[model samples]
Target: MDVAIIGHSLLGGPDPAPAAPRADAVHNRRKILDAAARIVADEGPEALTMNAVARASGVGVGTVYRRFGDVAQLFAALLDERERQFQTAFMAGPPPLGPGAPPGERLRAFLHAMVDRVVEQRELLLAGESASPVGHYDHDAHLARHTHVTMLVRLLRPSADAALTAHLLLAPTAAGLITHLTLGRGRSPQQLKDGLDTLLDGVLSG
Candidate 1:
């Protein structure tokens, strides 16, 4: 046993950190994702096939399949990339939305930022919800938003039901609700933002 341990140490312990992706692999992945985003943005989710992505990206269809596995997973990758950027912004970017703002102002900024998020990704978000109705509440993005809001609410209202308050605050930003209001009821994004501000005013004042 001691000899084995000594041999392992000589071989460089525990396998060096997993090697970074090959340069070509990284380049191909970016192209495929950019292509997928364009297809979804231009023609919506239904048009996003492996073949379509391949053509748009100028990569082979086999490469697309190997990289993303399937259309659903590929679409998910797109959402994941955009979600990371949004999370970074509110978690660490500037004041008002990121750090350093009072809980009230930070909460307000988050709700307003959510309005922009929905507007920018309306089609994708609606499609995701339609595909997995119950999963929305448990989604990584939703959980992040909920946790952020819950913390802010706790800070602003020490005696309030922060967890429940976070849920209530986020309810209006639901994709289905936003879609119904903006598309089904002719309400604009700005109107939605204003409504959020008004809602926050009441919540924070209480």
Candidate 2:
């Protein structure tokens, strides 16, 4: 897929600003998100409740509800911010993971980076995936990664089914799979990256 098309489709049109949000509103929103993130990090996704977040943030429950409809939406907002950062890193931040490297190298680097991300945020990501197995594929985070992988795959193998291949490549990196490998099998991130490199060797050389 064309990078521009992917950006447009995944990002959608920007919403109009509400005549500059109030400074207090902005401060409160950041406080809420930060507190919720800390709760999830220190405890777990199950610990992330509206009341818990309000208490942690020292904000009113009504304020928390007004900003984020529920715990799920709060998680989504956190994930959105994270995904945007990842997208920026891979799309434009640096070489190998970004625009400067050869496509084949970039593809390998991308998978390695993904392994790191999934391992680091395994619990939250698993929660997101568990919320909807199939619907998760439709998320902007997944689409952005898919778009990037498809582009690299096409460059590496012009005749390959880039979209399908991209999906296949990403399947192994799913949060559930990573959790199973890391927690269930006691595999390290380096082990996962090595395995991805082995897979890439065959796919790219084919």
Candidate 3:
């Protein structure tokens, strides 16, 4: 048997390579992402720009491009953390909104929670949609939401067209639609929640 020894231990491989200098890259990346998030949250999505992020993160503008590419890519990464947190809440958080409650009740809570989520990230979501409207329906997060809703619809009524019903249920939650209903028409988030409640009644009752 031939043993190949590259660095140190016979099979243990070489001495640990120099600690990756990427720690600085990672730190800078976090700074940029956090800065982008704060800009969106504090000043609105319109405020997010490569230059603004560079200034806020104290990194050079070129570094922003190096770390996250262009504006569209930055927007996508910005949504990553938020989408993860929102999904965690309804996917595994607690009862009526999560796993422990009856399917009907859980679905209702999920829809309402979704309304609140849209309100929370309205500008960010709208901006992301504007940047990539065609891809929105095909987004992994969107598909995951659809899958979850379909499961609930099926659980509530085995004979229902669960797939179609899931799509319909999610229609009202689109950031653009929600924005139109609220900012364009002077409707409120509470009203959106009420509408979703009514919608759930019609869908699940039939």
Candidate 4:
């Protein structure tokens, strides 16, 4: 399965709401998001605008504004959906990633998976981090990942400062840094994962 599709399915399968959204509203929203995702994927987030989205989605500019407020909010919603999918994968989807593995192994798997996700969505994520540097730390997705990593770190080294250690471990995987390493330095995702494993070796072995 496509990673995004698998993640999306793991997050919730299909909507099970008893009261489904209005057909037209749902259609319009899907169109807008599809257009927006394509635009960001093709031209980068900086190229996104309500007018551009409206034209691409075949919706009126007023409709785009009514739905998303602005470019930032649209990107926020997009990121939120993607983040939820990622969280679901690591939180409840499978062994090593979700559960049923040793703390060290799961932590390794998590880091590798995160590297894949960041590389796949580098543009959107870089834009998000650029939009708010400190705010990234406060995002629900980041907090959740931090909490999971903290738990793993605590299991691996009970005496260590798990919270701080978690933050330290995650710092290297920050979107901007990943973007720089991949785009500027031409590092592959596997290389990033290998570096993460080297860091884990020191933390886990000591």
Best by TM-score: 2
Per-residue lDDT tens digits for candidate 1, residues 54-82, read 99999999999998899988988888778
| TM-score for each model | 0.89, 0.90, 0.81, 0.85
73-135, model 3: which lDDT tens digit per residue? 888777866776666777777888777899899888888888888888888888877877977
Query: Which scores higher on TM-score, 1 or 3?
Result: 1
lDDT of 4 by residue, 23-58 (tens): 998899889988898899899998899999999999
lDDT rank order? 2, 4, 1, 3
Summarize candidate 2's per-residue lDDT along 1-206 as a digit string, tens digits: 33453244332444344688899999999999889878887898999999999999999999999988988788888887777778878987788898889999999999999999988777778888999899879866788789889989989898999999999999989999999999999999999999999889877899
Residue 59 lDDT, candidate 2, scale 0-100: 93
Backbone steric clashes in candidate 3, count: 0
Model 1 clash tally, residue pairs: 0
Better of 1 and 3 by lDDT: 1
Which regions in candidate 3 have their CA more than 4 angstroms from the true location?
A: 1-27, 42-46
Report lDDT (Cα) of residue 82, candidate 1.
80
Report the alpha-carbon TM-score of model 4 versus the true structure.
0.85
Best candidate, lDDT: 2
- Predictions in order: lDDT: 0.84, 0.85, 0.81, 0.84
Q: Which portions of model 2 show Cα errors greater than 4 Å?
A: 1-18
Candidate 2, number of clashes: 0
